[model samples]
Target: MQIYKVGGAVRDRLLERPISEVDWVVVGASAEELLAQGFRPVGADFPVFLHPKTGEEYALARTERKSGRGYGGFTFHASPEVTLEEDLLRRDLTINAMAEDAGGRLIDPCQGQRDLQEKWLRHVSPAFAEDPLRVLRVARFAARYAPLGFRIAPETLALMRQLAESGELQALTAERSWKEISRALMEPRPDVFIRTLHDCGALRELLPEVDALFGVPQPAAHHPEIDTGEHVLAVLRQCAEHAQPLAVRWACLLHDLGKGMTPAEEWPRHIAHERKGLKPIRAVNTRCKAPRDCQELALLVGEYHSHGHRALELRPSTLLELLQCFDVYRRPQRFEEFIAACEMDARGRLGLEQRDYPQAGYLRGAAAAVRAVTVQPLLERGLEGAALGEALKRERLRALETYKAEALGEPSDPPETPRP
Candidate 1:
């Protein structure tokens, strides 16, 4: 049997990128023969094995046929007769269809190298339409290679649009859809992922809440971009620029969804959009089965991000309520994430990209000052049960109030007399 390196390992190597993992395709080998040689069989859909020493995956060269719909509707044929070219033909993109032999000989029956040099994302064959997941994969590749100036071929884009229009995108499961989406959000230009899906009409099917924001208007004074959708993309780009974690990025993407539901009669003004956004945010989170951290952060941002942006102007009590809303004492890191997402929103507008967001630092300082208040002092004073809880809260609020007063260069409130 002849083993050849295939897929992303070969593609990334050709582009001079750092290779993370290697996959091998064993040509002219039957599954039984590999099993006899002490290889561990692992593939449920086809013939895949684990190398006894290296532990890397070794899939037999195989061909696939479309049996039904979505990504699962496929039949595979793997035998000693399957050619390397046949296995390559079943891949999604031309760049991923190339392979390399042990002797360093290049195999490019699909013109992948030429497309790579031209900076194009082209489909390998008509079989590309068989799997709906390829649409998201191509968009993700666009996001990954966009910094290198890659563009999806017009023909391939047309095919993607065709698939989107065919209503096949809904066939993907939530887990599978979220897998592609979350990965795309982590790319350097995640905005391109959403834009590409929207261009192909998949956004409306897969993320209609986000899609609704495209034409919605925002106050030009606050959001120079004016389009809610454009503002969302700008926020996402800022998250990437800051290298924020996935929860922050996801919150940035979904925070403004409520603006789309604003009454057009109130044009350019979404007075309560922060509160209005909670439903759609919850809907998207439930649909995607989002992680607890992501869902909780997104919901909080949806409900109170405006408060974060206006933190310096908030009343001391309001700031205390906000701190409690996020439970900052127990999850300070999540509070930091909330601030990062809010800062992204504040800066993600036309001509405001470089503006300062003092709200983040102000809120962080408030949380720190409150967290410093020890409940042990109140408990030591014989406070108990509800009285103890109330004392602790009052102490935290007093510290936060003094912190806010210092920040504003104002005189602090007189200390409260101890209750009998």
Candidate 2:
């Protein structure tokens, strides 16, 4: 029952990266043998155990056979006879197939170390195409290591393309697909994830809404990038550069869906794209089973990002309506995320990456100004019921008006007299 530190722990250590978790592969070990030694069984489909003291996972060295469809369609065989080399052969990427002995000696049966040094994300074997999930996993790894100049091997990419065209990607469950997408979005080069998927034809199967944006044209004056798809990728890059949170990044990715639906006759001008985008955004959110926060923010950004870009020019009533739409009073943190997404969009255009986006600060100031106006003041003035709601609205509007006036260096409008 020899245990070897394996998979990500070994790969990251070799790359001088911070290891987050350690997994052990136990060779020449049976499930009964592990259970007798105090290891808790955790895997439902395979023989994986948890260490009683360390709580880390220890999966018995096993091999898999494709039995059906999708990623879950696999039969696993784990026993005392499974060899470490055979187990590694079943892994998706060569970089992740290597392991380390208990004495810290490297194990590289698949030439993973050489591939790592050469900055390649190569598949361990032709068996890689058996699991559809590997396509997403490889794209995610590309996003993670793109900063280190790592790229997917051409042959591996060909396999990914074959998988994409094999109708297997459609068999992937929403939860599994979203798990890869959400993790990829958090990586340093999330744009590359989308690009890699697009290159291998997976994006069209998984996210046709986003894939359609590739050839869509936009006004070159406003979007020097011209291509709506490229602009979206640029926005993702900006989100990464600013270290924005997941919700913000997700919103940025879907914010331009309406532009893809624009008529070619309409060309560069998508007059009411914000309204047009809401349908696709909702479809994507539902399909991905996105978190409520992520879905809500994406919907808001998709429907009103143009409003955010036009913050300074909007009337106080429009500004207040936008705030209400975001429920800024109830969820100020989400409002901040919304603002971050808008800023990324504004900076995402070609040659405007460093341009200032005052809209974010302006919207934040508006939220702060309205938050400063309390319903208590109206209640203290003998207001009640429907009248109280009206009075609060009036006060917030006046506050927003004043805030906008101050921001623009203009004379303030006189406050409306309180109704009797």
Model 1 / residue 323 / CA error / Å? 0.5
User: What residue runs in model 1 are displaced by over 4 Å at the alpha carbon?
Assistant: 410-420
List ranges where model 2 is wrong by over 4 Å.
410-420
- TM-scores of the models, in the order given: 0.96, 0.96
What is each predicted model's overall lDDT from 0 to 1? 0.89, 0.91
| Steric overlap count per candidate | 0, 0
Model 1 clash tally?
0
Pairs clashing within candidate 1? none
Query: Can you write out model 1's per-residue Cα lDDT over 1-420, one digit (the tens) per residue?
Result: 999999999999999999999999999988889889889988666699999888999999999998977878898889999999999999999999999999989999999999999999999998888889999999999988999999999999998998898888888888999999999999999999999998898899899999999988876666778898988888888988889999999999999888889988997888888888899999999999989999999999888887887787788899999999899889999999999998888878887787777777788899999999988878779999999988898888889879987886753643211100
**Alpha-carbon lDDT of model 2:** 0.91
